[model samples]
Target: MSRRILLVTTLLLAGCTSGTPTPTPTPPPVKSGFKLVAFDSCEQLTKDLKAAAKKSVGPWGFSGGMMRTFGAVPDGARSAASAGGTADKAAPAFSGTNVHEVGVDEPDIVKTDGKRIVTITGGSLRVIDAASHKATGQLPLDAWGDADLLLSGDRALVLTHQGGGDVLYDRKMPMRPAGAELILVDLTGAPRVISRYRGEGRLVDARQTGDTARVVLTSQPRITFPDRPAARDDDEDRIKANQRVIDRTSVDAWLPSWTVTTGDTTEQGKVACNDVRRPVTYSGRSMLTVLTFPLSAPKLDSGRPVSIVADGDTVYGTPTSLYVASDQRWRLDFFPGRDNRTVPQETDVFRFDVTGSEPPVYRAAGKVPGFLINQYALSEWDGHLRVATTDSAQQSSAVRVLKPDGETLTQVGEVDGLGKNERIYSVRFIGPRAYVVTFRQTDPLYSLDLSNPAAPRVTGELKITGFSAHLQPVGPDRLVGVGQEATEEGRRQGTQVSLFDVSDPAAPRRLAQHHVKNGYSEAEYDPHAILWWPDTKLFAVPVNEGLLALTVTDNGLTEAGQIAPRASAMQVRRNLVIGGELWTLYENGLQISRLSTLEPVTYLRL
Candidate 1:
């Protein structure tokens, strides 16, 4: 294959000499034709076998064993009854006139029509009347307990839990079968189950493409158990043994499968491979999935390589390709009598085509030397696939846009001026611009102009005191950044909501800021997710305590209402929907509220 390189001088605002330029280093050639050599001597054979044995035993002893023994079984292992378990009750009363509750526990709400909101909650599909703020009808699936839900248009996909959780630290438990079912729920009509399909592994995620829903599963490998305890008549020994059993068992193991639900029939097909990472819907017809494997053989005597680490696991899809940002390390092999192992240092981006017959057509992008691409976001615009990579090095925080072919990666811009320890947390594409949130020493929101696809330039920035946990774009030139703020004394003050205007690509200005008292003690205000309502201009903030809805106006943001499901406990808004109605989630069940009335919509039984 041929290669091309582009070098451009970056102009810093600090007023440095412009004429002097540094030469970019040429990337090393990709190695091919090197065959996997078989061990000939007894010493070589012993080394190879030992390495394989260690690789096999490490994961089994720790993660697989624990899952087999103590993890929840397929039928949902009942936890030893706790004193605080709550039971389902009749729907709560509605009080507030401007706000009403809608649904809870992983509620994904979408505006099916102007007056109706369709939601997926507690593994069921329901339609809510916008004006009445009440569930018009619902289709319940109590059989698939504790299922993960995903929605695309009028289709709802539920991934039923496979068998027990894996034993991560234990080594004595036997591997149990991990399985899940894919159920399709149609929400356009009376909300009924359209089709169902079964698979061998747990479902991790589901992507909807037209009438078909492709579910991603990771297959659980059978694990071996320890025959005897490591120590006899010792409490520590017993505890260790139990931990080993839990570690060895496969918990939530899933293999990839695609279920095509059309009309009244469902057909299931499996991906020809395993170790599926992230699956995403590319367009309206096909899906994109990422498959990853180790680039080098395991070493028995050495610890795991750190340079090639896998940190963030997110699958971003464009129209034609999928961008996966994986943690990778450069493994330097120094074996005597082996072919001098030096070129192509075993670290970099592995690009794959989504439409290829081989599925994952992986090819090296470029040498990210001494740095790993931690997190990335993919966007498709005007027939170009744009990738924004977050560099691992704190001092060299940069974003690169790569051509879909994976061969050409251009460094468009860098987030400079901040402290070396600052890191960019999230990146999202809004129209022809890319918005990035930087965290760590300094928290700021930045907007970059991608009008020239190959040469992205940063046009505007807004420095805020609080670090953003999540970001949602509201309109063409406006966005809402949500997170918590901390004082200079290292004390968390409260939750923060900030709105920015990016009408001018080169200069983004903060339009408003909202600070709400968290109510809980200083230590309990961790923010997780944020959602914006374009129609009502409301921001739904889910924190450690509960959910809060705030309205944004010309003056600023005002807390319209709040919901406290529990005190001082970690309650995540697994999902949020703000269409014609309002929905919040809890661990045990869901809470629905009406956005206009600020009252309880209805509490449906899970």
Candidate 2:
């Protein structure tokens, strides 16, 4: 679900009392304070969940719970214009999906392999031939909500939700309808569903390595509660009723249930109770499950799954590690009229080993003082996990380094006193260096040298009037920032693109900037919405109502042209380059244009 629950809370950091400055000795390193412990049996799991519910459940419900490839062509990609190119012409170069890591692929609404483009939109899956610039095949999907897909050699793994948004928990009768589906599609010929896996949960996010796809999901106990309170019923009465519902709820109600349909032969199952684990501290209101699927399989099975009795909002993955983080909310933070600002805030991160063809194995767990902004706030480098966090109560931010020690992520190094009054707006980790942007009245772009994990230090700082919500690397010496320009008073005015020269780590400067008044781009919050074609130096971000295309000139970014797709009913979700054509994706269909001149080529209404 795209809906985010804003978590602003007080951070508790232990330190020496503030008084006459006395020379205090350095303290010893800190170890992870928590770890995941498996339940002895389903009965114990049920008892622990019930106890947590009785202590934290609210009147409405348990609150909270909530490329790769550096532009390398995809594997088995055919010639760009093979479907219709003349014998004398050569296939034009194409770019693949923009990914955080080289080998790890992130799921998106659209994907291409030069010759053909596969996309899920408007409640259907469509494939378009790049050379012909026409829809070659189509498959109508069921009544699933918004969807995205991942591509293998000849298969596509599509993720969809029953309800379009986050699972809503309010004073409602059956709660809001919520479920998720994983549809495997065959792309050898016409795009068609081969197998469908449906489950009761919200699709968190997913990552793919080679042909193996791992999907993360979160689900609440399937126990029905009462509707809106009557005129006479108070919060106390509702809370008691909710507690009673939890009392009678079975352990199966908390486990994720799923059904796999392959050619009408359906099978059902639930995450085995013995396979579930939970951190030392958790609300037990929700659970996080990770399912593994091999896209090359003829029929999809309810994947080899692993479950944990905790809620996760952010999922960050590498080829070897998958990290799930959740804001450790105070039990009463969601209660009526409770001031969250006074509640102690912390974030718990669980690490899983995702190597080989097997399911993810829970490795270790850790805790930090404050919550993270998103998956970007975390970066795994050289066996150590680096985290950036903002403490709202402290009005400050910090970067920490932790390494897996035994069954814990032990804190090894840390640097504090960053952006005194602002939180982190963007973070990018490149090798041994890290860049962070924090803003309130002014944006402070700080470059930190993380070569020494135990002693990371800020190398330079640049205070600008605007803040970048996303940062994309350029040739190892520059960065392209997409965000909004703001006034000195911290009021955002419009969309802004900036080119920075970071060749000198201690003295980074903005080479050029472009602004669009009163405009906003989805790239600010979603890096997937932005595309950077390094070959042609083309950078595109969806601004305001259309695609704002820019080219990286020798000195700065220049407005190449704009592509206003004909699919007016849907917003421009993604942009890709195939051969010499630029393909723009909308919910209704696809639009192709010449990459050089931005001339319209053809429109495919799927």
Q: Which number leads on TM-score?
A: 2
lDDT per residue for candidate 1 within 299-396, as digits (tens), equals: 01111111111222223333234333322221112223322323331223444344411233443233232232122244556655445443334233
Candidate with the greatest lDDT versus the true structure:
2
- lDDT for predicted candidate 2 compared with the true structure: 0.75
Position 287, candidate 1: lDDT: 17
Which parts of model 1 have CA positions greater than 4 angstroms off?
Answer: 1-146, 151-155, 161-180, 186-204, 223-312, 319-321, 329-376, 382-396, 406-419, 459-461, 504-507, 519-529, 543-547, 561-606
- In candidate 2 the C-alpha lDDT for residue 580 amounts to 76
Give each model's whole-structure lDDT: 0.40, 0.75
* Clashing residue pairs found in predicted model 2: 67-102, 68-102
Clashes of each: 75, 2
lDDT per residue for candidate 2 within 77-128, as digits (tens), equals: 1222211111223435665566666667777677776667887766788888
